[model samples]
Target: MVSFGIWGLIPPVLTITLAFITKDVMVSLFLGILSGTLIVAGGNPIIAILNLTDMLAGSLNDGWNIRIFLFCALLGGLVGMLSKTGSARAFGRWAADKLNSPKTSLLMAWFCGLVIFIDDYFNSLAVGTVMRPITDKNNVPRAQLAYILDSTAAPVCILVPISSWVITVMSIVKGSEGFSSLGISEFEFFMRSVPFNIYAILTLIMVLTLILTGRNFGPMAKSIKYAKETGKLYNEDYGPAPGEIEVEGEQNSSKARPMDMLFPILVLIASAVILFPMTTYLGAIDGESITSLGAAMGSMSLGDAFNNTDASMALFYAVIFTLLITYIYYTVRKLFTIKSASDAIGDGIKSMVPALIILTMAWTIGSVIKSSPEDGGLGLAAYLSEVVVGGGFPIALIPVIAFALSALISFSTGTSWGTFAIMIPIVMPIVVGLAQAKGLMDGAMLNSVLISISAVLGGSVFGDHASPISDTTILSSTGAGCPHLEHVATQMPYAITCAVCAFIGFLIGGIFLNLFVAWLAALGAFVLALVFLPRIYKA
Candidate 1:
């Protein structure tokens, strides 16, 4: 294997630059993988091809990676089943009558996005499918519905404690070097970082502000104006709306109720919440050799309990349990025949094929970067740590730098999870090293690490929100029946507005090292930008 040192940056840089130029994520990522393999192979074309194949196989073979892929597919199937049963249609009709105003329609969509926070993919499609008709009836622009869908999807999932996002992030943190020595459990660290996740918090707040105030700016303002006055949801240049994306239920069934849709979703959420704690408690008892359940529970903190828990396993079981219950309920009520329900499940999994491909490629490339010398991969994280330690960059500014870099990368790649997989292993070690060098460990150092970690997550979501090629972005457009480009164009200003405020917030947090003060400054910036920026668009 060759040692490229700083030259290791070429692969990702090439990936990002090419993605922006071509606007094709799959091609961009494949080329990036090939380039990395070439470098590792010392410019041998044949060897590079062999190395790339091995990398892909290895990524797919990992237990955690395979489980996550399955989780996404199964969740998609559950959503499809809900749509097939007429649950979504009933709920939409029920919601439309209750939400008679445009503002209420937007709020309801936003609320549904919040409610289905288990996974972002599910959030985008489910919210869009359920709320599009309602929003359309109220003359809410498709662009606006897309915005609400995109905003609530990843942003809400990243903030919520019980989500797959939290589980993945915790696992990454636990596996990081020097993490165990810090004397903090992964869950505790994750909880601490929540307050520092400024970008997500600010974005959600901005969504509510815009919804309540009924203010629009930039391209979105134009779209809303056109929709309101001319009843045209799309720009004149874009094609006709795709047949409204909807799920049709059995025409013969008169028994379909809104509860048919809601019950399964509520069960899914409850199972996740309940199973997480139960699994954690059980694991603690078994692993720690505690004599009694009460003593085991009392022996550890909440974070400790979570650290001992098998989150992926618990989530997998929860989803499976929910699906089984849903299928049984539908069959028992005669809403769907067994064969029909089976077909719906198959169709649902099929719907996620494109997303699955993207995710697999993303994971494969991440493996390419993280692989060791013996595996013929560049250890980017170690190289970065060496540079930061030896280089003259200020430690305090790390959070700001991290936030900007993550945003740029995610925007270019159109995948926040991929960005996280690449950034966390690299960023966390550097933060911990810097803190140690300064003789800081618990309070100040831990806070710095948390701020930087949260910045990476928040910036990624912000960038994904702005990227036209992002999976969630595309899904949101599909869900809302809006032309994809129209959604991207209209949502850009709102995302940028929040991102700018988040950037400034990270700077304040880095310099002041105070989460509360930084949050206040960021909130102030958001209000000022929201109030003033629209005037320029008006002109």
Candidate 2:
């Protein structure tokens, strides 16, 4: 059964454990995919091989992922160039000389991760790569750096209005005939619903607090302790050290010009802003409603509507433009040689090998699940939700449980979009039905506005942020070059802390406040988490 694939947790977990235990992530992941293929194909090795081949092909053929990988590759190239060109080092040196404090550098790193809300995958890759060395230079562990990037990735997107996610979610909601039968404008309802999104708000607060206060917990806390004790984190036992980047050359003595750092970064942000929404509009349909801001064009090309060709093209064009501009800038300024550019691209592609393999495996497993029995998926998900929220538990507690369940499902399945695509449609209708039954429609009574809002937010984002198969999660681990489970393990404690506070806030909102007051209280709770928790982290 598709939903029964919650057991799907076993594959990735085992694979990650194999990597951790044997100290070889690539082999472990490949073997894990083989194991999953066996399970899904009923142990017939012949069918398993056939399915595996198809699954791998589908992953490679998917235009969306190609765009993502290309973005990552380009980001890698950009980071490589920046480092070789002496840009990143110059900026780091300047920051060290001026900003000076670990707290300020960490805070700046956190802020950069938080504000890049165009797309979570892009945010995770770009921020993690750019900030890792900077954070490392300040003695921050890669684990801590990974956590900051992971924390900001999905949470920030949920809170923003014009993100890639917003465009997609709006399209889904607007198109769902089931939702339109309720006579509410989707965008307006979504906006109204945003404030009570406790997970997003709280996660953001937790990240900021962690950055400012430097606390680490769970595997993260352990990783930080290990790094402090042994002077390494992530691949410390095997990977290159900070000072080992270059040896026995004048290059080691050369410092980068500051403009080298600022220019590529500025180009990246500007290009993303100009290009992301442009693609969405380019993908819009003639009769479909479009809500995001970037495109002034009212109609999309035919190629945009039914084909991956258009969407992928838009992403490629955007990335190519950014890369070209970056290349031209370096050329004009005499900061890069053509040989160096070639080397940067080569290094970037080399770095992507592991990520490409992991992604291929993840997609295979997803395809495997989708091919399972239909009743299995919807039934199991519904059952899971009911078990968590359907008990005699107080209505106020439902949202907390919902968040937990969604987080678990997402973390296990490794696909937030899939989790959200399945969960929100189901949960939203239930929440609305409950609100109407309780006479809480439009603040008509003090029934469960807080409860309803929290359910949707927690359900949607829990999966988005934590799912091992999640694009954001995969991207974060790949970007940070930390082991995948290492990323999940380190992030769990922080995510749980925010979830707990959100639950408490939900209780207060449901029991004691009006809808408006309830949302304000939740927002206040988010700020409170930022303040109190920062003091507790030992990072």
Candidate 3:
């Protein structure tokens, strides 16, 4: 990879700065991409303009990107159908009677978030779509809902050993030549690293504590207080929220029931979980013996199926089918006319237009950062890797170094998977080289390797969990009907809190090589935050 020296840092930095300052992500992303292209084009203005359009177009050309775009839009359409039919309102009433309080409502949303942990995209969209009305009835702010959805999505998925995140992570580690020499299976290594993933574990704890204790702090607290005083779920001061454009028909029907809102969503969740694994399983299965679904199921364990699953493709298929089911389900129940249902679906797709545009620009900039150096791309990940690893840090500080660099790279590129691709290769060599050079083949060495690898994974998630340009971050706000910037702003304090604790944990782990002790120390700081933050920064 070609190096751009310090110049590679310009695009994401410019984009992030502009976003906070201007409160306009589209303009920020466009200018960010344009800056990178200009640098890549070596000051040729005309060439940079041409390159810009090409890269933007090129982002959608990738199959996974297009699939995810479609899935989000279709999911929006499904949510629209629920809203149009009065099912959402009915469900809200039902929930308000049962849940009764803000704590219960938020906890239910958090629980729903944890349940749909197959993919972060699915988790955020599905949980937000289903739980927003419930939370709204309890007067819980949309910003709070978005924060829960965002906190749960990536953190839960990354921590789960069977999630889509696991597939990407395991593939990276399995491909490392040094890993094979360690004589442990990829799954075994992943399981060992799980305890060391302090950020994901601790963030979930923060969410739970916040929900239970009503510990609102920073911008999130202000949003909560504003909602309580004004009776407005959304604060208009920020600007128009995306995912609020869906057309609605006033439901005059008395037949609307909670199941009207729920059955279709249930099918969607069930179908995604069942369909994705089968799709992944059947696609990867080989030989005549695995000719049928039963045969395939018999062939591999459930974990194997998930490991092979393609979350984007499966979600797109699941949403298309779920849309069909919901359309028919709503019409037959007399909640909507055929024409009304069709219009709702169309309007739902319309609602997602802003999110799509932001996603497009985000992907384009990511491409500009990832593209070959010769092709006017910065090779930003490669550049960052070279610059960071070239410094000779001590072995005892490896976990801290791994975490900080991984977070930086992931935040810069807005992709944890991209960070893993860059960092894992660099990180693996360090641990493996140490093992071989010292000829140490003991549990201490194994614990060191596991903690270092876990640090990289945890650090990567820190960026994905909070970065403004991250796709999951964008989707969380869209899903919850909160303005995107509000989601980013409110989430920053909590994300930073967890990230700091995670860094401290890794520093302890690196020095002592004890995962349990390091985690406890991190937990101790987190406990202090829980006790003091609400008192210090009251809503």
TM per candidate comes to 0.88, 0.56, 0.66
TM-score of 1: 0.88
lDDT of each: 0.79, 0.57, 0.76
* Candidate 2 backbone overlaps, count: 10
Give the 10-residue window scoring lowest on summed lDDT in candidate 2.
241-250
Report the Cα RMSD per candidate: 3.2, 8.9, 6.8
Ranking by lDDT: 1, 3, 2
- Candidate 1 lDDT, tens digit per residue, 1-539? 43358767777677767766776667777888899899888899999999888887876687666776677678778877876777666777789889999999999998888887866876787678889888888889898999999999889989886565666676566655556657776766787888999989888888999999977788888898888789887775765565566565656235677788778878887897777667776766764568667867787876566655566666777889999999999888788888788888898889777666666666666656655667677766557666777774677898989899999888987877666765776688787777777777578888888898999998888877788778889888888888888898888888998888989999998987889878988988998998888887861
Clashing pairs in 2: 3-377, 5-8, 215-537, 410-467, 411-467, 414-468, 414-469, 414-470, 415-469, 415-470
**Considering only N, C-alpha and C atoms within 3 Å, which residue pairs clash in candidate 3?**
none
Candidate ranking (TM-score, best to worst): 1, 3, 2
Please, what are the lDDT tens digits per residue for candidate 2 over residues 283-351? 453444755433325455433332222333454565577678888887776665788777876775666
Compare candidates 1 and 3 on TM-score and give the better one.
Answer: 1
Q: Write the per-residue lDDT of candidate 3 for residues 489-530, one digit (tens) a residue.
A: 899999999999999999998888898889888998888887
